[model samples]
Target: MARLLRRFAETRPDEIALADEEGVTTWRELDERVDRLAGALLASGLSAGDAIAVHSANRREYFEVMAAAGHIGLRYVLVNWHWAAQELGYVLRDAGVRVLFTDPAFAAQAGEAVEGLDLPTRIAFGDGIPGFLPYEEFLATGPAGEPEPQVMGSPMFYTSGTTGRPKGVSRKRSIVGMPVDVLALAADGFATTFSLPGDARTLLAGPVYHSAQWMFSFMAFMSGSSVVMRRAFDPAETLRLIDEHAITNVHLVPTQFVRLLRLDPAARQDFSGESLAAIWHGAAPCSPQVKRQMIDWLGPVVNEYYGSTEAGVNTIIAAEQWLAKPGSVGRPQPATEIRILDSDGVPVGQGQQGEIWFRYANGDDVEYWGDPDKTASIHRTGGLFTTGDIGYFDEDGYLFLCDRAIDMIISGGVNIYPAEIEHVLITHPAVRDVAVFGIPDDEFGEQVKAAVELVEGIEAAGELPGELMAYCRKSLAGYKVPRSIDFLPELPRTPTGKLYKRLLRAPYWQEASREI
Candidate 1:
């Protein structure tokens, strides 16, 4: 891959490689920056497999550092900017990060967090910080004439754990690195598959720390596609960039889609343009209604891929197939194998609800950092890692996810997946968002409970608990319906936009215990 980057620099030195609100960077500039950064890292005594933690938001320096790290085989950890000081401290200590690259906005807080720790070095970008190395000074080291090619782990991305503490998943270059052969396939299916004539511009709006953004950004760089990055998600600014740059591809989360759709309808009145060939949505489930509205608003360019930070790319639901399946996540990728297995590890027949397990023929990372026990629990015998998601495959081989296995509610010997009920509840015109969980019940062991966020105007009136209960009773089975409903203005979500159902369940369980 280092050779590939060098080749691109030699072939199209002046071609634009990256663009942001600040300015654009040509391939030559990017290569030069990476070379200088690599030299600086080596001079700082960062050897192969040494961990360098980056604490920043979306920026070109982040990508440059990542490429340089990958080029030299150093493990680059993309830290979550939203994490509290205590959380950051834990991860830094656990990874034994030798160097920390931080954004100036977070310098004060990050400095406080690492005060007593034996951190190797701290380099602050944008706005200088006293007692810390500035980004520009660090990059002035210049290229060290290319070090030995080290093919160590590429990245250590932390998962947004809704159920427990986030786990770091490290993938070695030989394992998680995307092969050149697969680039042709991805290019054919994802970016400019058919035309491939004009220069492709991809808009990256998500945070660089997340796997979804990393995949898109890395793929764009490898494919020689120009990338336009946004500092953060801003609907108006995002739309403006699309119009200005004529972006051909975009990768977004479902939450971003929701906000973008809510922008003044007039903003999209005559928004007819063929520049956007594809819009990839993933990292969390999208409401069926939301998906439909997106298709209607943006034509049929929406595409969804299902996988985790641990497994790079699992399945892809193309536009044509999405129109047919509606809620299906499409079939597994060509090099992957998926199976629906019962609790006993036996494969379930078609249409049976079971845990989803996947294995890659081409080899993939399948463990959590420093937690082999948990890793073993998930990545079971024979290389099949249980996704912990309960779902079934249709006769046509389409995968339909019900809900997380941990989120399932079992009442009086009846198993219920909250997604089945949440799907129905979200369809209600009055309900803006909803989360379903289980609360303890003496009679049934556990009873279904829902926490809902109502649409704006509906909340002005008093509670409509009875009306919502009646609505659910009419459409769902009496046992499957939520036993109680609590309305809230919003639900807690992870940085990646996944609902924190465990937090919602905590209060109900605590109250039940107090009553007992």
Candidate 2:
């Protein structure tokens, strides 16, 4: 990271390297700031392989903290800005973060989360907080020069921890004799798959706390590409930014696509994303209808991949290819292997639904920090790792993901995938958002249930419960249809597009003794 930043500073010192609502930072300026921040971290009694917690939203300073930490091998734990005090506290303590950096927006939450903890330092940006030092003021405390003997740093991403505590994904640092640098391997794969040019102008439309966003933006800087970021996602503004900035690449999720397509038709018609070369999306399963709609509007620029925070990019499907294959997540990319294993850990036949496992060609593995038992549970006897997802591969080798194993519904001994039902429901004109899960049933072990949020002014459809059920009955098997439909104002979803199905399902199972 230091080498790449230094190269850009020397050759294209004055060129724009990154920008946000706050302003822009050039290569030379970014390099200088990164050096000073690294110095400050080191001067604060941190060293190689230490951890720092960055609790903030998408902003310029978020990247700065990452860039600084990258130089000195600090593991920067990405704290979800939406996490409650308990959630925040769990991750901070688990990662053993020596210093915590937060923005003014989350000052109270950050303070409350870390209260009574043995934290060494706290730094705040954008505005002053009671118990924290000003970020800009603290940055000045270190010398404005490069730190010697640079070692690579990495970010520790916490899993959703839907059932328990969120586990920090700790990676092994590749040092002497390591055949490949993991970051370079990952960056090269991203650059090649997404067509990121050295002169690439990219738009970061999602929260930086996400692993995909963090990896892609970090790779952009390493590739000498300029990044344009927004503090929050606005559908129309996303389209306008692509045109205004001549953005060559951007990342999004299916929910964002739904919002973008929901914009006034007139606004969408005016957006000629002529400058867009790649529109990469993942992190959630996209409805086929929605994915097709995006492809039609974007002109074959839409790209989708399948992977998780624990596993890196495993498969990528381009817009043109996706139309022919329909719902596949393309073929596995180079240096990645995909395997399907049944409940007993036996290999499943092609087109057979089972747990999806990933193995790095470079022999890399992932472990949950400080939780060897949990880490051991996810890893197979081999080096392969499963994120507890169920999917299968076609004869042509394209992978198709089903619902998460944990989310699979079993009714009357018949297995049902909520994703398939949700996919059907998402296409309903009146349904703006929906989540399908299982509720405890006396007759069967579990029964299918769906909670839906209608589109604005959906009352025009006359509370279409009957129509939604009829719509599902047309495509899905009767057993897969929801036994009951609950109309909610909105579904519980994280900003990154992960549905909090656990929260949505907990209420129904409160009186039951059955395990969900």
Q: Pick the candidate with the highest TM-score.
A: 2
**What is the number of backbone collisions in each predicted candidate, taken in the order shown?**
0, 0
Worst window of 10 by summed lDDT in candidate 1: 172-181
For all predicted structures, in order, the TM-scores are: 0.90, 0.95
Instruction: Quote the positional error of residue 470 for candidate 2 in Å.
Output: 0.7
Per-residue CA lDDT of model 2 for 1-516, tens digit only, reads 255477778988998888898899998888888888888888998887788999988877888898787767787888888888889998888888889999899988998998988996899985568889999988999787777557777778998767778888766433322222445555666687678865788898888888887766777655667889997999999989999989998889888988998999999989989988888889998999999998888889898888888887888899888999999999998889889999988999989999998888888888888889989888877798888899998998999999899999988898899999999999887888999999998888899999999899877346478788889999988889888888998888877899888999998988888666
The true-versus-predicted C-alpha distance at residue 109 of model 2, in Å, is 0.8
User: In model 1, how large is the Cα lDDT of residue 217?
Assistant: 68
Give the CA lDDT, 0 to 100, for residue 445 in model 2. 89
lDDT of 2: 0.84
